[model samples]
Target: MTNTRSRGAASRGGWIRQYHHPRGDAPTLVCFPHAGGSASAYFALSAALSEGAEALIVQYPGRQDRLDEPALKDLGELADGVVAALAPWTGRPLTLFGHSMGSVVAYEVARRLERGPGPGPAGLVVSGNMAPSVQRDQGVHLMNDEELMTWMSDLAGTPPAVLADKELLATIAPALRADFTALETYRHPEGSSVECPISGYVGDHDPHVPHDGFLRWAEHTKAEFTVQVFEGGHFYIEDQVQDVARSILRDLSAFVSRRLARHPLA
Candidate 1:
């Protein structure tokens, strides 16, 4: 629910990274990042959470410090690695938050945790992505590396500093393409959708995922359901982080209050 002084790392060849604010009293909030993104994506998010929670963000490999790592081409491979890597943190009433490609990954993580030998997540937050059940992917992942980078450039908001260099873009292209493939081609395991409280966040103007795609999440979580629109694009989670952070904090607060009322943390 919360972070203190915790630390996190993933296999250099793996597809996830992590950060921990180590503290036992705070609830643990596990975050998954967008495609071509690392845990650093949520660094500012910690400040937005309630004081009673710590943030543990997942760093999808293939970018930032793990740039040398071979990025994962399969969404399941990434999700499996994520669930396995964070095995130690699955205890207690955990909350999972995912944005963009992260939203799907978080949903998958929730599914994995449900199937795992542990308590399911107390709350679920999905942002900037369409529901996994209904996809309109045109097989952009099948695009050659050059086209993939162009697609990512047109779609994602990877820092300009990184995108400006041809050599750097060359290095990052495969992973970006892989991320697109992972999102585009991934199929939810047969009949596995979570029944936890789910809140959906979307960019008011994101073209990649539309309202209809987000509505499909209703078939998944049986707990309380919600959907909110923001004022940006596919990456609205970043473009309007403060507003998004406030919304997230609000939901996290409600979850905490309800949880403490039902099962006080001693």
Candidate 2:
């Protein structure tokens, strides 16, 4: 799959990938991929929102084209790198979306942006993960290769072909472990919350996220909070891309309306 780089996108040190370009005035939607996932995972989503928004998918280190780069084992460091890479794309209203480990990273990035000089995210959408405040000690990152593969298989997030291919699994294992280590070791400060609204999404049968887990995201936002449960497992978006895209567009529209009400002249 060939990807087109928007002007200056290549200057971000390969941290961002743009699959489709939207109108210049359109809102920006920055997507963070799940653990062991690459920016290509969002190609379909970016295509879906091509007309309504500019979608920028993050490309984390140590995966895909960035295989040579070492993956960061700390979530804070990962967030820091993302925040820095996003500095060039903050001119317009932006919304953030992330799944699984990416959800936590997006939250951290939103927090940092809120604390910085520029405007923070117009809103945030967190999917397939629990709230940052809720911490569990399931150390899958420390598991042996076989055990880790078993857990991944149970989650059904990985493709069967990739799982069956030992060489492919071995190639991605280090980056997968690094992502899991960052996710598992992350610790959110009590009472830390973003000022923007938050929308949570979860699959009804996702084992990693409890049935009511998405609701916890409300605690991390100071503004309006909402959640929608979809059918399927952790990778529900794969089957419900249109629905997910609609939900995102709906939330983004609402966020824009709210912002307009607050600052009519801007």
Candidate 3:
């Protein structure tokens, strides 16, 4: 496996980012970042799993290299863009992992893929988000700049340095607002569920979603469902990257095993 990070023009796709090269035979783990986060957010996890899985992080518009592009304000549109952009990499087994708002996006993408002719993701790992069915209308998108920054501070998702720097906060506010809008306004239709196994993770002390809320994800998956509780808050993965990577790899391995059992000749 080749380990390298590329952010040059050649690496700039509207959606996917492959920071490291893994074995062709390795399963692909497609990661969706939390709201206001860029693909670079998953760089460490990508590096950690470089040998076991090909990690492809989604880069939504209005951030990083795609800064010039308009940010999507609807979850459906975001999921559509991701599903289409994933065309070339669907040949191998795929496991979708998403955090915060990205969890719903990953669920939607998995639903779309299963509805299509191709096979759906082998499994889904949702972190720091409640099941889509549990709707909460948080008006974070409607907050003014000051309020928005304050909210981000309370959640501890944004760094103190970034929160304190007005100039930097202003730069990312648009994308952040757009993401909030998409998340707040989105609703998952009743009975909408995925065929893939779903694994949920959440920090024990997360302010946004409680442990029970995380377990509600079981309702959205027809297959096996499991949950892992970690220490800290919503951004727990920030401190537990290695443990998270190990859990993800274990899920990916199980997915592969299940896939092989279904089609042993493959």
Q: What total of clashing residue pairs does each candidate reach?
A: 20, 0, 0
Task: Kindly report the root-mean-square deviation of model 1 from the true structure over all alpha carbons.
Answer: 3.2
Task: Give per-residue CA lDDT, model 1, range 190-258, as digits (tens).
Answer: 666785789898888888787887878777886787988888888877667678777877777776666
Model 2 spans > 4 angstroms off: 1-6, 10-13, 264-266
Model 2: pairs clashing at backbone N, Cα or C within 3 Å: none
> How close to the true structure is residue 49 of candidate 3, measured as C-alpha lDDT?
85
Tens digit of per-residue lDDT, candidate 3, span 146-265: 999998898898889999899988889999999999999999988899988998888888989966677889999888998888888999999998989999999899987886687563
Which has the higher TM-score value, candidate number 1 or candidate number 3?
Answer: 3
The lDDT values for all models are: 0.74, 0.84, 0.86
Model 2: what TM-score?
0.94
lDDT of 1: 0.74
Tell me the TM-score of each prediction against the true structure. 0.86, 0.94, 0.94
